[model samples]
Target: MLRELKILLLLIIVVGIIYWGVEPLAHSIMHPKVAPADYEFKDLDKIDLSKGDAQKGKKLVTENCTACHGIKAEKINPPMDNASSASSYGVVPPDLSNIAAVLDHNFLANFIKNPVKATELSHKFGDSNPYPMPGYDWMSDDEISDIVAYLASIASKNLSDKDVFTQACDRCHSIRYDKMVALTPDADLERYLGTKAPDLSMMIRSRGPKELSVFINNPQKMIPNTPMPRVGLTQQAEKQVISYLEKVGDSKKAQRDSLGIKIMIFFAVMALLAYAWKRKIWSDLH
Candidate 1:
């Protein structure tokens, strides 16, 4: 029994050491090889900004966007707590208020053209809508610009960071700022989103705007097998979301940084005093 017990202990230690030594390499090898990025802002540089008409955009918004989105705070999009919408899309559509501030015109225009192609996910996936956002490919360039303009006009200067969070990120992620932690469980997230979504609270601190923009534009290309779909937000919208994260995740960072200088000065003064006392005591001993 003693010999058997020793063998078991040795086996466990060996396994643990091997796992520790080989784990990182194993994970690297297992990681999916993402396809090269193909997603980009189509015709954004070529757009004639003079052609966009906000008034025309408003009319287009009424005809196309209002079905799943509402501009007012008092009104809710889709009019009911309908599971079918969530069943089809995996999340309820977000409100459009302040969208112009969060998303850039280029991404919004491309996304509006086609959500599926822009996000670059398999359209046949169970979570993706069977009849997704209709692409206005037939619309003239000016008309599409007008639609983007209308969406842009809805942004309000008075809107808070929380409002931006609600509009863009609340459906898939939940952050408990009061607790200073992320609340989503990996299992629940995988079930609902087909992969675990990271808590966004600290994301901006880790990833800057440029990298995030590419990731958000096409997640699959950035990290293969990642479950996050393209959010299809405009460039402005992405900025606002990042800004909001900075506020929530690193709200105290500025204050802490400022306080660090004072702390260092105090420590330096204390060290000098200690050195002086040590010299005085040694002088007496000598």
Candidate 2:
């Protein structure tokens, strides 16, 4: 027994040393040194959102965006299937149907101004892709805001949670809820999106809304090498999406939490009873 105890002690010491030795290295790797200026739109967190005119936004979308994006259930370009679209561009550009329902004004403005910078990939990798979406850096900030407002104005307020997620997130993300499955196969998905997207069923519970908001708004700000694109969702749409996530992932959190307290109390009572019974049984011996 003493020999076994010595071996166990040695094992624990080795493990403790290894953990302490690796901690600093892990921290350094996770928090790489990058100049503040290197970060794209680093000042966006401090920028104030400007209200936009949807009527003006509509004109801008027609003049600037109709080449790639479609609206009003009609294809501005020929209806190319997913394969064809993926072949042309690395990934298919999602439709803008009711986009205002998913994205907030702030996100729309930032993304529309410079999608590459918003995603932060181009800032780091220097635009390595063969087919890149050019940024509208020349468009005045007001014009971008107006475009966002236009999208928001036409957004369907009555859209279900699933519809919002499908339009906003389903293009890349996969949620393993009920019958909902991944849109792209693994082989094809990796070729375009760079990596297989993680399932978001338990995402809300794992990372709360605040964390999700920061990450969703600017993934690179939170995670240095994430493949997630900049999805400029409206504030209201973000809330709706969070609500849906809570329904799917943490629906029973309240009930489960309540039950947990009762269970702990029952265990405490049983423990006390067990101790009292032990005392009674040993009284005669004492």
Instruction: Report the number of the highest-TM-score candidate.
Output: 2
TM-score, candidate 2, is 0.70
User: Which parts of model 2 have CA positions greater than 4 angstroms off?
Assistant: 1-42, 45-51, 72-78, 123-127, 182-185, 202-214, 234-243, 249-252, 284-286
Model 1 pairs in collision? 102-236, 102-237, 102-238, 103-234, 103-235, 103-236, 103-237, 104-234, 104-235, 104-236
lDDT of 2 by residue, 182-262 (tens): 554555667766778778899998888866766766677677777676666555656677778888888998899999999
lDDT per residue (tens digit) for residues 69-99 in model 1: 6666325365434355455445556567666
Where is model 2 poorest over a 10-residue stretch in terms of lDDT?
A: 33-42
TM per candidate comes to: 0.64, 0.70
> How far out, in Å, is residue 6 in model 2?
26
